[model samples]
Target: MYETFGAVVQGPRVEFHLFLPDNARDPSQYFRGGSPRIKQIHVRGDFQDAVGSQNWSLDQTFKMQRLEHPHGWLYKLAIEQDLNDGYYQYKYFVEFENGTQRWVSDPIAKYGGNDQNENSAFVIGGRHTVVHPIARRRPPRDLVIYETHLDDFTAAFRHDKTPVDAFRERLDYLQELGVNAIEFMPWTAWPGSGFSWGYDPVAFFSVENRYVDDPAKPADKLVKLMELINDLHERGMQVIMDGVFNHVRAGNDPNLGFPYRWLYQVPSDSPFIGAFAGGGFFEEFDYQNNCVAEFIRDVCLYWLDRFQLDGIRFDYTLGFFRQGDAGVGIAKLIADLHQSLNQTGRSNVALFIEHLTDNRFEAIRDTNDIGAAGCWFDPFMFKHFEYCRNGNIDSGILRILNANLDFAPGKEPVTYLENHDHSSIMQEAGGRGRWFKTQPAAIALMTAPGAVMLHHGQEFGQEEWLPGSGDGRVVPRPLRWEESPLGGDAIGTRLFGLYQRLIAIRQRHPALRSPNFFPFPFNHPEGYGAFPEQDVVIYHRWGQAEDGGFERFIIVVNYSDFDQRIDIPFATDGHWEDLLNGGVVFVDNQKLRRQKINSNWGRIYYRKA
Candidate 1:
């Protein structure tokens, strides 16, 4: 039925390898053949042969060669043309001499595809998926990220709606809030009793069918998901999916086998270490093996190539890397993947890791040197929660902040006040009462440092927790629509307004986005105001404004609550306008503004002059 290419006969169990065809320029040239174009490229082989056709426009025309050899044969791809600059998805079909055609996946992907029973490979050309300079060029320092489950976010805006309609309804709402990016809990399909966080997915390559138009066809579902992504892009929204590679769903997984038992790691000598949230211990991938590494790499490439996704948030870093000599370390895994992605010539995508371990800052920091864009910092949440819940500063805050200061500006960490996992916990702790005292801490979370993320429903002050483990006991996670009866009024409105104004201000000013601190002397151990003690964090952004105007602005947040005058020092001596308030302040003479400040609400002074 499909266009026919030649086929190579091969034995069923022989090991075969395929690579991107290389061409040599001269004697000095070490390559083999020219690269292949999807419209023109073709391959036929022994066990399996796949091609990275690079044909993006058509669905079926993009499908390239499929070959199989009954004897022993290997396949190599030669692409004589280039597809210019764009994203591409590729799969291989193997037709045996016995007249049986099969789909073979790319063994090189970080994570494999769901459509192919075997493995479908993927790669990005001259680009890797990264948050663009425009998207985060001027990120809001003070962010009130509303962490919403993708399903819940859609469901909240709909009545008797299908998944397609639900996703379509929330696009404008998400854009209206001016969230820099929306972090969706994993959308990959997984079998569940009902609803799931989507952490235990067997089909990493496919979007969850629950949200698709057909909800039955994998190919059709994938196309629908892509359409949703295109719509989001049209609206100028970046999408980040929570990736759970640490575990897999049993029975449903075909790679591991039906009624799958190899998905979990159990010691031969003892019992299970702990039960995984998705009903399995963990599907441990042997990272040391080249095959395993290739599989993971392909998975990462698939999403970037297929959907043009902005970024990926690795759910649990601890589980990915095993704990021994033979085992691969997280640093190595991240570095290798980063290097491979860098080949695509795209801006470095934000690679954020969830380092929940208190003392593992070093381990996480090393990821940067290995080419990671950044990491998720929990210290922001802990300090804020400690102050909110216990009404006191914890020693842990100062220690972690000081240690984290080692990182250069704009590359420190991904900071957030609450997420789906933690919010659920906070809600349960409140019992009949409020989990976190409705206060100004939300303001502080947005202004803190690194890349910021807001959990869904946070803007609406949604206080219900989703049913799950991890940190669900403290914060509640549920769909609380912005204007619904279940949502709070004054508190939610105030917080939402604060986030909007702050985000707008940050978007207008660059200095506020990438901050540089200038510590002021403090007498006591505890911080007097919102910031850490003596840390009078300052920032300087060097560049022309978006409108091609020269604008210089400075942000001063006094961490001390009591009236304290600190020397204002800078190279330029001139009159600076306090943008937050319509007042001119002398910066040359260090004219300190003194005032009584509240314990939680810190003072922010911006320069206009």
Candidate 2:
């Protein structure tokens, strides 16, 4: 430690300075508070029985000469030297009237007990700077996304040093599953709990302490997590982090009135609810509060700048909307957040909003039109699952499809059959008895319009229902990395392979991923053609002028028990290949074509160049 000190004493102010370390950028050379939960720190020292200012500042050279002093304050404590790696013990000394000095340390130190003698310590590491370009780019419409939680991903396998490498190993499985993006559940730091599912993050600036063993140092768990992320990007996968910006845990002391003294909240005099959503679960702040905006903005920037994450799926986004042009609509916050992030001079990270409201789509459409975030098309997923899984496919499913095709002009909405909230598809609609019935509906979900989401292990029929109430959200489901095909014939594996094939096809054919697709009139018998029908629905993606323009593809779904014959009317003079079935039908002119399909086989016919 390079130790030096200077003092120009005064009553309410003083000048205290220290020498800087030779290598400032070295991670292990710096000092870190033990708990990731602590944000702002307050340190005070005394001299001649007088108390001094607790607030401190550090300059770029790690030297501070002048500092504001409170009245009756005289002597001040300063950074003697840049802290080195490993645990070091230090405390503030207060000189009393009797010439006695008292030493004190932070009360919130992690290594707790009656022993304040050994002060808090932090291990250090090098900063992470690598980022992926595709994270923030405008993606294709036909994306297959997987929702995952970091703690859950590693918890089941973390015996010795396995959690870090375990996630790395799973990357192959995710790629095999054919997902374009992986949405992580909350993994931020939380104070009281076995696992928080990252919802109760105490420190917005730091990565979750639980995931990283020695978060203070560069060679610790946080760095390992970064390695996992970088590895994922190398494989051409997009990653989205779940961002929670609504509330924080209750604080023991109130500084700015945000429950925890650490968070900056709008003063109660401001025109907003200091406490909202009853029982003070979510505190409402005045959007006029600049500090509030600054805090969240810093958090956003920190992740994008540090971790190189691709996107952020904001959780409970509707909770913070204020009543003004820039602060009123949830859209405004997202728009502003995206704009600020763009100034970082890096890849643009995608934004997605999640709110439990019918009007949520309105905000998404408005903001996305101006390039804020992509649409979260949950309603479409809900309706499809309801029709297919519940065995209630009828006019209702058609209504949903029509609305989606009409409302979404140039947006790629995220559509999913099941997510973390609805843990199990079988349990949501009915019971285990209804599991077999919903299998056909799952197929429709994968093939239907817009972006698609698949919960982890949902493909191979792993049904683990997460507890809805409490901290159990972070618990991982028993991952069947061990593939178990249904009936020893690998039926589940076959279905997963089918999904993989669709993803490959979508990636290869740009039209499948295009946002501009026109729906054709499917006049099948019994009105089941496009009414949640899997046999005879036709969809077309009008291609851009660069690729010879306007590609028309017909998607036929044969959900019936028997094979069907089609005497369809088409004005095409070329060869057509079936996407689902392994066969080709040549149509030199407008004529009828006949084909056979399995019970739940979905066939797509496209023109071959």
Candidate 3:
């Protein structure tokens, strides 16, 4: 039987378990000698007050008993009588070989306490946890994603500094953006009780204490998250967590290392900390250890099951992906998740990887081998940027835009022009003044045969010129909603309306979501091909619809400043509705219509079905 680690509330008693596996097959030779030997563990907390002592009194510490497990050894402490009620804060005062001792927080703590000493807390008489069901579920391909950081997103348009106070009300405005999915950046527990991206998570199970309204009552943090997710689901939008499982921040510094890493005498001797790949970004997880894989999988499962998350966007899989090693790492993790999901009858839990390797084909291969919904397709973003900035459009650009060519028969690609990693699309377009150029780019993004994504506020032209420094990501990049269509900036507001219209078109028309992207005009090789000189391209997208008929759409993209008249091929002779601009153009001949498309714009025409 599987048991949960950390503090588990079982009936009237709270049972705490600390996992330290005895690994004979550890890849590290250092594991043999000078390994951490646990002599004793004392539970120090406010509960000691019930035993006639002050809070966190170490006068006579509460000792834990060690027991053998299937994997290795575990330190267990059960508290049923010591709890007199409201809340309790605790930490482990551990003694190792040769009198080497250190204090460490619960590695899998669910809630943090108000202290710089890294304390884990639990509510004694709290009600059982609530698991909210998803209001509406959606498949991966039909998603339009909007990525945002909770702090950056909430910090904007509010002055009182109660970040989540007005958050529920703000969801209505966000729902109007036409995004069916919201991809939030990580909010896991970081080192200090200050601002952080939560990328270097120390406690995988705990939410960042600082993000909550009150650090002492940290369960409110989890409740707020659940409530927010419920709100999004109710609004018909799925939520995707920016899950960072590849590596963790580890060091001797009190404000930098994970509790698990600090528990060992020599941190390097820990099986969970080692070099899995050559990424060298942080303290990477060594998947060679079975316990390490299980621990991370447990962390992932806990969040997904408890929070009722619709999906997870795995951050930086390159840090752990071994060469063709399918047993551990991303492959086994994904396989394990799928098996669990299947057994529970949960469907449409999308898993995407950000293996931004230079070889773009590698993502497709890995996604196929390891079972992921898709990879963040960034090569298209690079090519699209070139076209937007320098008018360097070519046939190769069309090939890249048509993701069907790369991601084959039924595979989906998570395509985006702006994401959390890159600067805003408006910034890449040299400023907000060149907003018109993004019109064609927006059309291409929506009409592309894949899952579309937008960085937060990208719809309303959020611009921030990121520096080359590493601090660029941590810099304040708030959403200027004032620049939106609801705001004052004329140029920024124009792009907002364009995105609204484009998303509506994509949502209503299934042809745009189909896996058919023809580079040639209506698949005619001798017809008007993509002109590199004129910076214009034409393509066709179609899919089989209900009633045994075909739904089709033609997209004419113009990249150059000059308005180009391109021959648009119509399959049927009737009135064609320009979905982007709501203009109707009649077509008598089934051949071609020489249409003059606006500069830095695109035309999407289809029958009103």
Candidate 4:
């Protein structure tokens, strides 16, 4: 179905197709007289016209025929010639019946120019030379994701803008941190300022040339991106790309000769636009339209096929729904995308969504029988943060700890304490200006029974609020690696060492990664300390043992400022080692071991056989 739209290249002949909605062409529905007549479709590239001139002249332009379809008018063009391999850019030149003409980029191009100027380009017979590493599949439950903006991570060390290749140079450091996957924020081409979170995607298929050393050679970016992916894959790390399909940048008006006007809608009565919301620059995509659907599908497929990415994290699924609806179309779109990607033989390719709704999660669960991964557990983070700051364990914390068991069984939710959107935990903790206080939160996150993630600089304790263009916005900011714990700072060093130990323990222990969470009973008179409602939380993670029993781990946290003692009942009377501090304790009586945990610290005890 996607083949019905966009340009399809076969040998020396290239076929082009464009769909103009019927309503858009109607006189009364759009412009007063009528929509543009689309007099001609013109395409020019390096492979066309001359051998190496790559010039676009009147002689190079050819006329395209308009065919009638059920959807609307379809402009078709077939060009045959002796075109060579490499980078080729093409655009559509259309003349209106009213004698107005405009040059527009190809909406379906696999590559394009920088954010300042959008011109679609693609590789002609250019094959990837880098041998991809053998595909290694890890269970969703075992994933330790590290999310970062590529430029932010690399630019922190360099004076100039960091490119994808420059970011790749830091793979060894990531591998050292023991993160299994890296989630890069939206890298697609966007307009206006180069420093951004990259959520405003103007060209979905093209790489952001702001990070590219050479914008003239479009294929160079593609090659460098591939190299980075291959390098990551070889290091046994998966690559997850952040995708923004909910909306497009809104400045392009139809009257301005923008070709992709049909992709968005700017209704006068749009509720999303207001003084508080900056007049709504995000025009929701026309997902109900077939042309838009195919375009999105092609964009997904292009990255998956070209770069062999491991997964895609779609931004804001709330925007996917139509007005006053139950998001039936949104569910179908996700299901269809999952099915299509699986059909590509990359069945292990993960699909995640940022839909902050319980109904959306249930819908995705119902649609994806194989189980679709959900967003980061925000409630868990918030509740834990509250407990840390207030030094109180409420019902909210208990509910969050037991969420997976009560709500969605057998599904692994991505968990995180801090991400690119909000300020770091240190910043939220009343500007403690130290990462030491956040250790308990970090322990809880890594030890939680699900896939976990750490935002860039979180491991080394980045104290500054995430850099962004404006106040409270996700603009680019310099990452001061010199202040990092790994940079030999005492406080940062302690935090980094603790993180490394916690992550290594999580990776080694199967019980911590298990979906089965058994909250330790603190109701017993002797189990919980003097105050059961104090700032102390305890739980147990277990998995089936080889002997058909359970391999259990007891996790105890002291959120209070002073020291506390937790008398947790052991599954068996034996020696238990504190996984955190590496101290071994012997339990003679069946009652259990009483361990004294330090203030603002936690301990993970694994019962020795």
Candidate 5:
């Protein structure tokens, strides 16, 4: 049986368990045999008095008792006392044998302090509880994901501060846009003063206090976050958390103090020491280590169970697999995570990995019913961007589009053109409000027989580059809600309407979401023998029909800057409806010749037999 490893409180008694592997304390495991030895470990915090005053001092300490377990030694402490029914902060005080004393927060703490010190906290008898709604469930392939940072999305609207409530206020806008899921770029607590992307996570279990309206109130942060999730669920949007399990921010900055460094030091024998070149910006966890593996598993399961999150997108999965054996180690770990989630009877919960390269797809692919639901497909975005910019479709694009048309197929790839990692389509097109040119790319992304995603501002033709440092460091910027369609921007409203129309078309047609994609050889020699130029491509998607016929959709895209006429070989087309413009075209001949098409435009023709 599996058990939780943090503080478990019942009534007035709280039991704490800390797992320290035997090798963690072994002298031979260190470089110079001078690692710190356990002298005393104490839990110190403020206990709420009847008068509502907190006594912020150490009044109780525990003697170290070690018990052998399968993974390592377990340190246990149980206390019974009268306390107020609210949240309280606490830290572990550890004294080494060499007369060095340090204060560290619990590695498995579910809550933490609001100050810069970032101490851990726990709720005694709070009102926060996980409530799973039945209406918010959807399959992975059916998700239309919208990615955004919480601070970037809400900070500019109110006095440069982004509270949880402010983000909740924008749910109506997202629903109106027809997105079924929202992927938040890491909201975990990190060590930063101003706004950050939250990728450099310091506490995986705790929510960021910067988003909480009142820090003095115990469980306020957790409650607010729960409310946000509940609100999203109620509004028909599933929440997908962006998790950074590859590395953690661990450095001794003068501002953060030495306590940050003490929390991340691993045993010398651990597998995470020399995996990367030089030293990475953050401390990477040793996936091979039992304790480290358990910690990550606990973190993943904690959010799924406590917050009722629908899914998790693990950041930089490529980094984890590059460590050893070409990601076989991390594959096993992910398999275990998938298995654990399955045991909970929530099989529809999605799991995504950020492995951008095409060859890395096999490593994260679902095997033995235990693997990720899909990976972030960047080749489609890169190739589509290049074609849109140059108006030339190379053979490489054709090959990538037809790489895996049959096996596992569309359900294993999540396609997108604009996300937080890359520049927006508007910025790539010389920063003008020429969003019409990018409409072809949007058509390709949505109708490509895969799950589609969009960045926060991409729907509104946001022209400003994502505000951040060169190395993907997040910086706070002014809220551009006024630039969005919801804020009365004309171009934004127009672009938003286009996005809404395309998304609705995808939802209305089952063929668009089917796994079967057949691209005709428009320019290929000895193929369809249609357009021999590289600037035009056509594809067909079909699904089984209820009337024993087939539901067919033919998508034609023109990538050139100059308008052209192309000949399409239609198999007995009577009348086809252009989904983009709702225009009807009649075709009597087997070959529809000299069809006029605009430059950088695409159309989805629904064949009505």
Candidate 6:
């Protein structure tokens, strides 16, 4: 078994493993290129059950012993000690070689935490497993992932319970939308104690206590979250957690700081802190150190084993991996994770990254080497955003839709129009007045290719604009479900019905899920661009049918203000069902001439030969 860091419960005793590398190395040029050695270490807390006395006295501390396996020893762990079966809070006090010391929370703490202050704590028998079995895995391309924040997604629906339970309370609403997967924006504890889009992560191994109705009992926080996961799995919905391993929150001050960033007397001497390929945001982790990679690798592994998550979306890859790093940084971490997953007989668990970098369309291509299934389709989102606003795709829409056309077999794209980082579809459609403009975009999102994503409240046209950058972007905007089609909004009603129908169409057509795609090989037009002048784009997707034939589908998209007529290239001459408006048309000549596509709308025709 892989060695676990943090307070790991082993039967009657707990093993507290701490990783601080460069212990016994020669001093180099930089300040403690060779980190200063720790003269003494102690775990002081109220872990012991003392009925008559208060726990966590600074004077009452447990001494630590170093484990030496090589020339430069790495781990300093607490001596094994049996304790009562219950929860306890603790922190580490380490004295370094330069004769300086400080008290800090467990950087790898698995449980127990608050918003402003940090206290490392864990239960004697705390490891939890989801009672509901993991839902059967689905290919990445077949997923319709709905990205939502824990608090905002449920804040408007219900606040009577924790956001996790609130989501469960509103579970049927999401299920009715036909999304098979739910991707939660970084839930590994929020930034400080305040509301966040969750990008600024302070604690990696613990759940944000504020999400719980009762934050005082840290022990209950994790299990309750697990129960929510169990319920999602029971409903045949996959759960994906957004993971931030590139960097952590910095600063020695309270509310939004990390303990490991300033755990030692000489802060820079800490092995896990520094800079690399990470985006210049917050404090980027120095991946040059093996300890950093190992620590995060352990975190991912523990989550998989304990939480039974179906997928994970690595936040940003440009900030995590470096050039020419063959066996280190995120590559090593992903390799280790894949190896572990294979050993555990896990399959079809999606691992994707946000790898928008220099030539990002190509940067995404390189993720195959690091063991990622694919990447967030940044180019696709930007292109479609412009298309939705401008009413056309001047650039080659086929290239964007047929993503990973030249990628390795297993690698694919996770496409989306709006996620946490962008404005809602209503906003992109130039407000609810031009809501019909979003119809084609939504049609393309579901009908084109790859794993699809729906931002929370996007199905019903939630329009709330925040700045593209700075603190203003992180504020919460709860969904207005009452304004949905079922409620009263005119635009929301139409969009919601369209979304439901499109999702149903996608699920009903196997050709939509197939990799076989073409840009309507026109016989007369002799052009492939879905540009403004053309006003129409036709494409075909087909899958090998059970009867040695092909299950074919042709998609017609209209981006202009007026209806356009086109010769749609059908794959077969047979009964074609118009999946969009519900009609049947006979195509005896393998082509439908003067087929009308409405303004800012589309049609999906499924062949029933």
lDDT of model number 5: 0.67
Model 1 poorest 10 in a row by lDDT: 1-10
lDDT of 2 at 232: 77
TM-scores of all predicted structures: 0.65, 0.72, 0.93, 0.84, 0.87, 0.91
- Candidate 6 per-residue lDDT, tens place, 1-609, comes to 223567877776776777555534422212223454577777776764443234555443466777754424445554345676666777778777778777767777766454345667777655465555465888787788999898888887664577877778878878888898999988776455668777777778887766763544445777888888898898889988899988888766533467666655666666667877746578888777766776788778777878898889998877877666768777887888889999989998888888877676776646776768778887777877787777766646777777657557777788888888887767876887888888888888888768888888888888878787887887879888787865788877788789889998887776787677776322235333365576677777788654666678888888778888777777778889888999999887788787778898888888744
Over 214-310, each residue of candidate 1 has an lDDT whose tens digit, in order, gives 4233234445566666676666666666777655554433343211122112111111112222222345543433433444556666676556666
Q: How many residue pairs clash per model?
A: 74, 14, 0, 3, 1, 4
lDDT of every model, 2 decimals: 0.46, 0.50, 0.76, 0.65, 0.67, 0.74
Q: Tens digit of lDDT per residue, candidate 4, span 1-609?
A: 443466677765567776665554432222211233455666654445544344665443456678986645777777656567766666666665456656666655556644344656656666556637437857667789999887788886645534686787778778888999889999887764457788877767777766664644555766778878888898889888899877777454432222465222322322211122112236666555544555667677777666787878877765665433333335555666677776865555667666555543343343234235655566666665676566566634544554454335545677787878777777765554635568778887877777788888878777666454456576566666776654777766677788888989888877778776655223334453224355677776778554656677777877677787656666667888888988887766644535677988988888735
RMSD of 2: 9.8
- Give stretches of model 3 more than 4 Å off: 1-3, 10-13, 24-35, 82-87, 126-129, 158-166, 215-218, 408-410, 520-523, 526-529, 546-549
Write the residue-wise lDDT of candidate 2 on 1-609 in tens digits: 101122322333333431121112332321321111211222332221222222222212222222332211122344433332332222223232334333323222222111212222222223434544553443535457788766566555665543555677677767876787888887655554345666654445445545655434423445566777788788877777887776664333331122223211222322222443222143543334443444456566666656777778877655665324554334545666667666765444667666554564575544444344455666665664555444444544443343345334545566676777765665554554444444555545555556677777666655566576676654656555454342343645765666677666655565555554334344334222453343344334434332565554555554444456654434376667777666777765554455454554556666634
The model with the greatest TM-score is 3
Provide the lDDT at 389 for model 4.
62
lDDT per residue, candidate 5, 553-578, as tens digits? 77777777778787765555588788
TM-score of model 3 (CA atoms): 0.93
Considering every candidate listed, which one attains the maximal lDDT? 3
lDDT for residue 528 in candidate 4, whole number 0-100 = 30
